[model samples]
Target chain A: MPCPYLEYRDTSADQSFDEARAFCTVVEEFVQPMRADICNDRYALDHESHCEIYRAHAEGEE
Target chain B: MSYEAFLDGDPVIVTAALTGGVHGKEANPNVPETPEEIGRAAGEVEAAGASVVHLHARRPNGERSFDTERFQEIDDAVRRHTDDVVIQHSTGGTGAPDADRHRPLRTDPPPEMASLDMGPLNRYDHLTSENTRGLVDSLHAEMVDRGIKPELEVFNDGHRNEVHGLLARRDLADPVYATLIFGPGTLTRPRPEHFLTAIADLPDGATFNTLGFGRHQLPFATMGILFGGHVRVGLEDNVYYERGELAESNAQLVERVVRVAEELGRPVATTDEAREILGL
Candidate 1:
């Protein structure tokens, strides 16, 4: 998917960090600073992790 | 954290509503009213842990005032004591029939931030506080025009919707700052579920602080920090610091919030950080 912050048209789907870097290299030439500032902090991330675990448990039961 | 960056992280901003308009000298002898007393009380609270001081002005006779002179006096006095603490003035005057509640904003030099009630709410089981939509729009416009950030006061789910609508209409800015007021016999009951549900409905880029009425202050305040929000505490919301014991000063309440934040492992936001977070 296209990056929400960037206005690129030939963007591909979301992928792992290495895959994303390779795709960016193929599509264009840019080296943007990777800042995790936009990412949620440890608390919110931990909450999300718990939610994923609960979802997996529910899926397994089904 | 960068100012804007920290808000996205939901840093807790504790505001001490030092002297609310509800109680007079008869209710709590230590409640500050005069300029000197109010300023001194605010200074102590800021020192304790509060980044912001919510102010309500009164004459020597202990009557609330929306008049500019009274507000200026209190503002000047607070400035005299401390320049780092944020000063927020209340728009809710005495629960009077004909009193102009918005008179403080009408003052020549308005407050840096003003309280804007989103909707009407019942107070304590006797008084009906009026907060019409037209009043909200007008007040919001004035505050935006005057470069004053409004502390949106939400008492229920409907009030939350109103705030959302205001933002959708571009009447308010991003990172919408609000105060979720919880009290008995009001629109919102003071409970964990009430807080959780209210917060769940908050829009993206929005931040809120919580305050409970009467004795429920500490519980809801504690929850506010744990739930990734801010806290507001003072005699204005509750006169008693503990069960059956009247609070001696606003500083005592501020000190309590400080302790609670420390216990919860949440760092208190400074005035400058709060201004940047709230876009004040």
Candidate 2:
């Protein structure tokens, strides 16, 4: 089963469910506006590894 | 207890690619999903002569996942069935979050081996299976730090090149294990001709395994046996047992390998034997 949000979101942004947890708070922040929507609940900033999050940003920017 | 079983001079290690990240019960109703199902499947495969289980943890809903808690559950479940059999967790999957892939390293009892995909892969066709240098470096560092072996996954020549460079690096220890996947796409077709040549190209003290997709799975596995290498098999590579027929269980695949090994006069390595061969 894919993340519930995967069907509507960018598939490229789609990763494993744990990845959503591993990434830092940025993606969560990006999806913050949609928190009220139960369909987007998987986008919370839980167990955000500052290292993976910041590095992903740095790599993405590069 | 001793690993002398592999030293009979004709040892052949069989690794079971249990439940892959892509497939579900729809593809094969027997595909293990829950911890209980995976554990039962591990027991069956072990009895059928599989020394290693290549795991791709899945959510309760059958979605591919890498949650640490879930992995721990899977690990414990597998151990409950058998202890000597090595548990190798996968870190590569299409859409796998870069960090989530490494969650295996963070498990309470880290896996004996975790997959480290080398270079890039063109998945299906459109998506490029990317493994950036930073990610590779970070994964290697984590593996070394955690005392877990890297089951290097090489798909193409560029992946071979990456392995070549990695062998020279100080971070990785000697006696690395490489699983060369063939028949993924036309780009990485399982070429039996290059199997030996690829192994020759690896640095000193490297063991290898082969995964042939679809129709090529069993043939390539035989090639590995004849070539003095290891083999990985399960519905993950080819869901069918024959033309248009779905396999009943991973154990069926392992049983076939055992029969093939017998015919070839090569002894299937026991779990203890496999550990020795892997230096675990």
TM-score of chain A of each: 0.21, 0.24
C-alpha RMSD in Å of predicted model 1 compared with the true structure: 24.0
> Which DockQ values do the candidates obtain, in the order shown?
0.01, 0.04
TM-score of each model's chain B: 0.91, 0.93
Q: Write the per-residue lDDT of candidate 2 for residues B70-115, one digit (tens) a residue.
A: 8899989998987578998888754456877678678877888889
Candidate 2 chain B: minimum summed lDDT over ten consecutive residues — where? B1-10
Q: Judged by DockQ cut-offs, is candidate 2 incorrect, acceptable, medium or high?
A: incorrect
The residue-by-residue lDDT of candidate 1 on B52-91, one tens digit each, is 9898876554545567788888888998888688878888
> Ten residues in a row with the worst lDDT in model 2 chain A?
A30-39
Query: What TM-score should be assigned to candidate 1?
Result: 0.76
DockQ of 2: 0.04
lDDT of 1 at B55: 89
Prediction 2 TM-score vs. true: 0.79
What lDDT score belongs to each candidate, Candidate 1 first? 0.70, 0.72
